[model samples]
Target: MRRWPRIAAWCVAALVLAGAALGSATVYFGWYDVSATGPHTVPVYALLDVASTRSVKLRSADIDVPDLDSPDRIRRGDALYRAQCAQCHGGPGQAPEPYALGLNPAPPPLVTSARERPAAEVFWIIRHGIKMTGMPAWQYRMTDEQIWDVVGYMRVLPTLSPQQYRDGAPSGGPASSLASASTSPSSSATATPPGDMRVGDMRVGDAKAGRAALQQYLCVTCHAIPGVPGARHYVGPSLDGMADRSRIAGVVPNSPDYMQRWLMDPQGIKPGTAMPALGLREQDARDIAAFLQTLSNFE
Candidate 1:
């Protein structure tokens, strides 16, 4: 027994010595390629990708999400994004700015990243900002609606093209957004904005009223989120769980006040925003904000 124990300790020591020797050789012999041009090996890249996604998702778990599918919200989002985000993230048409590509860990194309994330995760990154990366948190600069719009656009980016992105600028070139819609059902809480600018808290009991207001106002004609069973259309990001987000444009701390302010003048928060001044009243803005807040009850 004593001999076996001694032999086992020697074997362990030998293994450690061999590992250190191998490591020293790898470093001294230039066996490990450190070139940027060399892409990661398949297994290495796969492991890294898994780790990256899990890290983002874990950090994103606490982030509350708002509704990303409304036209007003997305339009406002576009406005803020064009001014700040487009340079790095790019859009359907615009390529990433030079700086974004040159960074060590290249900025993830949001259009592609969305497929891997929940809207809340996207919103969290927008609000909290990432470290050692080109991405910045919009917190303090933009409103909630604006962030949701970017999230909404991201949800359906796979279907966009460079031309559509250029045209989709809210500045009115031609191509407008056509991102994917969430399949989640829109509850009474996720009511659409009213036609005549009536602003107020949405009542679950008044879902019928909210639905009526949605159609009468032509809200669905151009913008469409998942609403009342089976009527979903791809006009906008689905409003499956809008009420839960913590901020807007990944900037503003989510609040009814900020939401209303954004609806009235999204451009004030971000210059060159695509969202137009919609001529909204205080109440109109509030009512719409109320409806949008309901999109993420699940999150």
Candidate 2:
């Protein structure tokens, strides 16, 4: 009986080792196709689905869902959804843009997703996007309140007809609403003065906005930016003490103008450099430079 038990243990260990070896070989030999054109195998798809679903469920369990039934909130969410999300995850009776079709794990039509997913799960997914999916983490661009508003809209999306979706939100899109809300008298009362900071002769570079822009532009994916939450990737040099650094990318003087220029067109300044020209807007470059200036020997 003891021998039988020992034999069973040996058999289990052998199976585990065999599985590991097969997996390693598959990876090392590149036998598995990763092309987005093809769909995943049934088992692989099932595994990923379970993993993602469970992850969302586990993480969203403790979320404090606010009352989301207000008409104004839903309208605001509708505008935001149209502006930000509709292109990829189409609205009711709306087709996603052609590009969304090419994505490997096709962006789910939110009409069905909204009906099936819990509010908390949807909110969490929007806030911290799914990895390897085209879905982006909106936390970098949108505030928590804005994300909640989207969630509120999603809760009511299943009930709206295609015509209703078109006629529901404001006409000028979310930009006007977002801009008005940000520049409202109440908000402007506490706004940072134009002269409070400057980057590259631009007085409009807000450090707070710059910080958010860094994440929005996915700079954290490559560089370990101070005060940004992301993987501590070493693909680019850390910007921990950028304020004190004497050179921009070890080429130009680390002045405001040079810094902004470097950010705007890194490849143009230093041809063949690993740094890419991110097509940053002038304001975005200035804001990023201002934010970088705040990273002073605090590593």
Candidate 3:
């Protein structure tokens, strides 16, 4: 019996040594293929896929997802996805760009896969992006709401056809199409023209420039603004109907000067608020104020 115990220990030590030798040899001889052309071995692929999925699930468990079914939210998400994601993930009707095919671990079609994921997981992946995959951390470029918007559209993407994608996709990047449309004379939804819409005693800044400044300040990440295409945020209050509101933060009067000051330094205006001071230049503040003033007729 004592001999048997010794023998078993030797067997375990031998197996460990053998594994170490094989691993070292593989690394030393460069036995693993790094080429993208060939698919991974079945075991390797299964391990990687499982690991990736589990990682996302574990990490995204705490994310609080919002209502992702709103038509307006989906539209905003569609524009953003077309501009930033279509090349890699493809749309309902759009094919993945040729460059995406060359990726070693091919990007899965989100139409089917995104449906399989929870919106919170999708939001986490979009916000933090996966490492070693070409996916980027859009936290720097896109806002929380914008990320959620993409998730929203992705949830419904499996149902869309190519023709539907073509018909419904917004014409350009959010920064361009929405800005131009908001300023176009015929783009107003209400009976009165947006150019003629007025806020009492408040000077409207240049609408076009205000739109540009909005992008520059990265306001789209937190506030969903009407006429701003993919500006689907939920972090802060929606600025869509700000023009008609009697108060700015529901505490102060909604006047041009108050808005400009608020824009210049939000924390100063409302202490302990979640809004950040984007450090808008005086003119930038004016331009944003002017653009926001037009929201009354935006619909």
Model 2 Cα displacement at 114 (Å)?
A: 3.1
Please report the candidate that would top lDDT against the real structure. Answer: 2
User: Worst lDDT window (10 residues) for model 1?
Assistant: 180-189
Tens digits of per-residue lDDT for model 3, 166-211:
5575567432332343345442221232244244544547878887
Candidate 3 local accuracy as lDDT?
0.67
Q: How many backbone clashes does candidate 2 have?
A: 0
Give RMSD (Å) of candidate 1 vs. truth. 20.6
Cα lDDT tens digits, model 1, 112-208, are: 5567568888887787676654467787776766677777767766566554565566643222321211112331113342464333543332333
Candidate 2 to native Cα RMSD, angstroms? 17.3
Residue 197 of model 2 has an lDDT of 35
**What is the lDDT, from 0 to 100, of the residue 161 in candidate 1?**
56
Assess every candidate by TM-score.
Answer: 0.45, 0.56, 0.56
For candidate 3, which ten residues in a row score worst on lDDT?
185-194
Task: For each candidate in the order shown, give its overall lDDT on alpha carbons.
Answer: 0.55, 0.70, 0.67
Writing each residue's lDDT as its tens digit, candidate 2 over 1-299 gives 78999999999999999999999999999998887644566567657878988999999999999989999998889878888997776664344554664565656656556567788899999999999878899999999999999999888887876445545646664323322433354332133334443435556677887876665454654576755653322345788889999998789999877888887556446644545434466776778888888889855
